[model samples]
Target: MSALLDIRQLHAFYGKSHVLHGVDLHVGAGEIVSLLGRNGVGRSTLVKAAMGQVAARGAVRFKGADILGLKAYQIAHRGLGYVPESRDVFPTLTVEQNLLLGRKRNADTGRWRLGDMYRMFPRLEERRGVAAGLLSGGEQQMLTLCRTLMGDPDLMMIDEPTEGLAPQVVAPVARYLLALRERGIAVLLVEQKLAIALDISQRVYVMGRGAIVFEGTPEQLRQDGGVRREWLEV
Candidate 1:
């Protein structure tokens, strides 16, 4: 099967500080892949480069086409959805309004809807009328995922979805990602939480110093103490 997103020898820069030194990665259709790395290793930068938020030099093929020179909005129009580490929800907007922003009914139809999202996260439904800024951190994260789903993206790149959330909240978010996979949506997840990534992803790529150092199944990652100690340990 062809990959939904394929990035080869990707190099990116933030002003003079060059990051993402020749990173190569891919996400196959309907598969959940995890990008695991420690802080400052450019995992987030990889996602940003894919989303075209930063200047990138390399080949980024989405659905078998080059996406290198496209703008961020162009990438989104091509059916890529991004949930940044910060959960980029509109603070002043109501929950319902925020979700509406992602709805592209004229485009492809996926299993994501306001009702479906609410079912996946009942808290969001309960707070539909409330302002997004007033919601708790966990609530905000859930809202972010739901809003992204409204866009009906074929491939979704999620950056650190479980970060700073309570364990109780993290479990449900992980389940939601699995559900997305069941619906045939490809997901590329960037996570610092090793267990969370292992629990949800079928394959894992460990990033060290802006490059992929290890690519294997979840069990392989668990059995390698050297990888765990070097790349994952705090």
Candidate 2:
């Protein structure tokens, strides 16, 4: 079967500084893949390049068509959702309103719904009328996930969902991602937290200096301490 998303020799630049060099990756249908890397390794740049949020020179195929030069909104319209590391949520909008903004009316109708989001994140339902800025970090993270789910994306590229959260908080988020995989949504996560990524992803790709250096099952990644130390251990 063809990949749900395919990127070949993807190259990206920020002004004149090249960030991604000949990066290649793919995500299959209903698969959970994680990109592991330390800071400033172009993981986030890969995500932006895939979503057309950055200028890139490479082939980015989503679903079936080439999406290299598409606008960010166009990419989102094509059933791709992105949750950046910053967790871009409207500070003044109420919790419900923030989620409503994520609703893509033109998207394919699937299992995702406001009720599903509410069930997945009970905190959102509880603070339906509260301002988004008032929520805690974990709550905001949950809200960010819910907001992306609202778009009903077939594929989601999430960057660092557990960056600043406590271990207890990361656990539930990991569980939520696994639940998403069960529901048949392809997730491509860029994460620094190796344990969380390994626990939730079916496959892993270790990236360094803007290129993918290793790809394997989670168990293979764990057993190779040398590779881990070189690319992941901080």
Candidate 3:
């Protein structure tokens, strides 16, 4: 069967600085695929290139359509969601308002709603009236994830979702991704936390210097310590 998201020989650049080098990756429907590597290996840039946030060359096919040159908003319109490492949120807006901003004009056709988000993270519901900026780091992260879900995406490329989060928030975030998978939403996770990623992901890819070096099941990744030591271990 064809993949939900397929990227082949992908190259990404920021100005003259070439970041990704002929990378190839794929994610299947309802699958959780994790991109793992240390910093500066172009993990973030891969997703950015796919999202059309940077200049890139190669084939990016989403749901059998070529999406390489599409604009970022256009990509999102195609049922593809992106949550950057920045956790970009409207600080001045109330938590509820921020979520409201994420709803597509016809979001009712999608599976998610404010009630679902509230149920997933009761803290967000409790602080629904509070400004997003005033919330804790973990709370802000939850808000960002929920906002993206409001768009009702078929596939989500989430970058560094667990970065800088407190220990207590990490497990819940993993569970959140698993829940998305259960709902048949494919996820391409750009994550640094190996334990969480390995635990939740169906497949894992290890990157080194902008190229994918290993791709296999989480068990294969765990058994191969050399890849972890050279590409993943801090």
Candidate 4:
């Protein structure tokens, strides 16, 4: 798998408070790489910076082009999708309407369609007529994930996708992510659930104090308890 999104010596800040240190990470084409850590370790910040939602940077290259200084929408149009920790859904819109908003106008429908999203998470199809705000937390999450996919992004950076879901809800979300991988979409997942991340990802990166502390295959990470205790464990 070749590199799809690459960051080298990346640093990010929020106003006066510096957050991410010089971090280095990459996600390969059609691969799933989970970014794991405890809360406030700058896991979200890293993805935000890469998506051009934050300030400061070193190198953020996606598909061999320098995407630094571009706006979020600009980066998104280039095939890098970002779903923030906040499930940003239009409350007033119907589930299908929200998904329609994500469709790129005048562009070739790449990989995702309304049917694809609905097929992946059948609950979305059932609730297509409902307003987004009326849905539960898990349902909103499903809507958000599918909405982003409707844009047909090649690489999606998802932040804390399973944050507040029940176990039953989480299982399908995990399975949907696997389904995305099968469809040749690379995922940069910011995940709090270590088990799901390890189970689905080919590789995992452990973040500590705004920097990458460990990067290895899931099996390698499973064998290394010290890295987990220092960077990931509660």
Q: Which residues of candidate 1, in runs, are more than 4 Å off?
A: 107-110
**Residue pairs with backbone overlap in model 3:** none
| Model 2 Cα lDDT, one tens digit per residue, 1-234 | 569999999999999999999999999988999999889999999999898888899899999999899999999988898999998889899999998899886535556777888887777899989999999898899999989888888999999999999777887788789888988999999988887888888899999999999999999999999999999887
Q: In model 4, what lDDT does residue 74 have?
A: 93
Q: Considering every candidate listed, which one attains the maximal lDDT?
A: 3
Better of 1 and 3 by lDDT: 3
Give the distance in Å from residue 212's predicted Cα in candidate 1 to where it truly belongs. Answer: 0.9
Query: Which window of 10 residues has the lowest lDDT sum in candidate 4?
Result: 104-113
Residue-by-residue lDDT tens digits, candidate 4, 144-163: 99888888889999999999
Tell me the lDDT of candidate 3. Answer: 0.93
Give the 10-residue window scoring lowest on summed lDDT in candidate 3.
101-110
**Per-model TM against the reference:** 0.97, 0.96, 0.98, 0.97
| Candidate 2 accuracy as lDDT | 0.90
Off by over 4 Å in 4: 105-108
Best-to-worst TM-score order: 3, 4, 1, 2
Residue by residue across 65-154, what tens digits does model 1's lDDT show? Answer: 899889988888888889998988899999999999888656345557788889999999999999999999999999999898888889
Considering only N, C-alpha and C atoms within 3 Å, which residue pairs clash in candidate 4? none
